[model samples]
Target: MTRDNGFSRRNVLRSAAALAGVGGLGGVATASDGESLRQIGPADLSDVPTDLEAVPAAAVPETSSGIGPGSMLFITPPGGGEAACTANFVWTDDSGTTYLGAAGHCFLGSSAAGGTELDEGPDLADVEVRVCVDCQFGGLSALVGGLRGEVVELGDVVYARQRTDDGTEVGFDFGLVEVPSSAEGLIDPSMPTWDGPSETGEINAGDTVVQYGNGVVTGETVLTKSRAGSGTGNDDASGSWTAALLAAPGDSGSAVQVGELGAGGLTGVEAAGILTHVGTSGTAGTNLQKAKEMATEAGLSIEVVLAG
Candidate 1:
């Protein structure tokens, strides 16, 4: 794995991208029996509230320019310039409010700039979600190659969870941005390239996992940006799971699914978690089931916007 001296969140993301190509986190965990942990199991979300508008077993209309999972998003930190991150999943509440998922850290300013510390969360009122057009095609060159795209103000942030409450138990490092009604038509709940997070799924040690990350450094090329790896297991009881999938700095908040690859892309996928942080051994994600529970506790009462 490639190593970098910098520990800032930005550099940490880039390092993860580099690790993707060379067999990530060489020592990621495996099952105790040394056998595959892959299994067909569904998460128990029968009690969770779902979107009132979702049609069961219906097809999700494809949108060429819609903003959804895999879209590039930017937000300005308190004292710093704009930073980029990927959207994880789409969510909705009974009141008909559409919310986009992202890492809580994406809304925070760097510690060096006198912003909230990396360990702490940002104030929801202070965050603004900006969706970027034409960013995927140009990558970083878009900024200097004169191919820059405009950033559209989507809406204000609704919630950003503090990583920890009492500094002992870890909290879910997730955030949600409200997508206004005027721009709701631009929303596409499906993931790019590899589709179908058919439903919430479970993650176990050694399970095969696939992800498509939109880190600026990885460019938007499907073949390069999409990755397949195996699950390492839960990092702890904090509603977090670990995996060795390919990722980069801007890939934070990208969705990960428990699935297998087929001729087309992913087949039989179950939305498992949202990418949050990276470690020396693997990447950590907020389990989707747990994220929903946390959102419910915060009075959001949301359901994952599903793909047909």
Candidate 2:
């Protein structure tokens, strides 16, 4: 996930202090107007459905089959901060274990500096990852269920070149998370709101593509256009692609699918890359091919689930 500058340490600490004053860290409270806002715990999946069949017959949240791009993922790092990012595709390992792909930095305490591997000291093995079940195309109002998982594994941190707020070109980030077995059946291998059951391929410049992310406002059904291969050959960050897609702080880990628009719409869509960082001009992503290779090196096999 992109480091939210707005959520400074001082602000976070202040929020924690305020919560402590109100009740406890994970307490629930009602505003003076009577609206309820509760502190969510790792096990507080009360809003999530316990059965896949129980999900409404509506959009079938991106977490389900036709696993769409903007699926909402709630990530709790080991160090005690909670954040959210969008999930990419659903893949299965050689042993038939399923996992949802996402940016690895979602579990980090801070953004990794350019040219460095993500420090493994955060104990990501138990990092909490959850997906909302009752999501719609424009909002997450329907209360269905939540699928909870953990970050069982992660990919290498490839340097993503981008210009900072001050226009300084610097290196940045990438990674993935594994969905637990318990929540596997709740999701499908399809891209939400688009054409899919697609393949994985390289993204070329000027290539029209669709980007998905679940921002705080957009939920998990937001879609935007991006042109791949736009910033190719201009930087040393090999195996990475640049696009003009608009991304927010919560859009980290969103997917960049490569495909063509046909008469049927979004035909041949496939997993191309995972959004790593949002720069002043556009977003940078880690090549999906490289991600698969990294998974293999780590003793895992991944395949995009296509709509049959």
Candidate 3:
């Protein structure tokens, strides 16, 4: 794999142009409020092992009252610029430490798309994570103070021969932001519009899904069975899932939920994946099950805690 140092504005523009030509499906959700939060670039494969055993699903309470998956999170990198992304879920380690998962690229100072720069480990001292209440796309809302903590771990970038229609290889990009003890009572593990306590389930090519991100209003879409392996570079086509959900730049790391569509509404919805890439055809996500295993290998005993 070829590694590129920092991604230039030119590269992001090129990516945007490329995406526009392909019908603008893979672009990161852009903040409608004139914010310039750039999506972090993909990474190259490293020695990180991918064969770790699946961490058993944890028991979720009957309900939760903290922030849900679709909530918007403001990530301020160590360098001082602020970017936004969707929070995946409220997670907890065996010792009861809380965390929120976002895209790993959100914290990188340079591109690791084809190199080992990440081996040196990114710094997290001045990094800050925050949540906004009543915030909408392109609009402002009240801040919930900083959910102070550092990025305790990052998901390894797994190399897969699989390439997307554009020939970009699939990658697993996720990061764990440790939550300060003071903010634990403020997060809710349930999704806003779905059932409580997201359960782990495999998503198929034709499954209906719902996603929540700060970039789009009403983030729901259907998976086109035909795009499963047609060249989206999604890792494990059988396990990964995508949809026509409208994602913008700041929407990275949004939670993708698996659900049943009906006249009444979505039913049996559960957390299935986290949005990582946006394409003209749809948005790609890493399977939640795989994310769990990756976290385990990183030496963090974590689980997606759900609402009761």
Highest lDDT model number: 1
Poorest 10 consecutive residues of model 3 by lDDT?
220-229
Report the C-alpha lDDT of model 3 over 23-129, residue by residue, as the tens digit.
22223332222222223222111211222121112321222123557555555554554455567776778998777777655554332322222233445544565
For candidate 3, what is the TM-score?
0.62
Give lDDT per model, in order.
Answer: 0.57, 0.47, 0.47
TM-score of each: 0.71, 0.62, 0.62
Predicted structure 3: clash tally: 28
Q: Show how many residue pairs clash in every candidate, following the order shown.
A: 1, 15, 28
Model 1 TM-score relative to the real fold:
0.71
Residue-level error in angstroms, candidate 3, position 287: 1.1
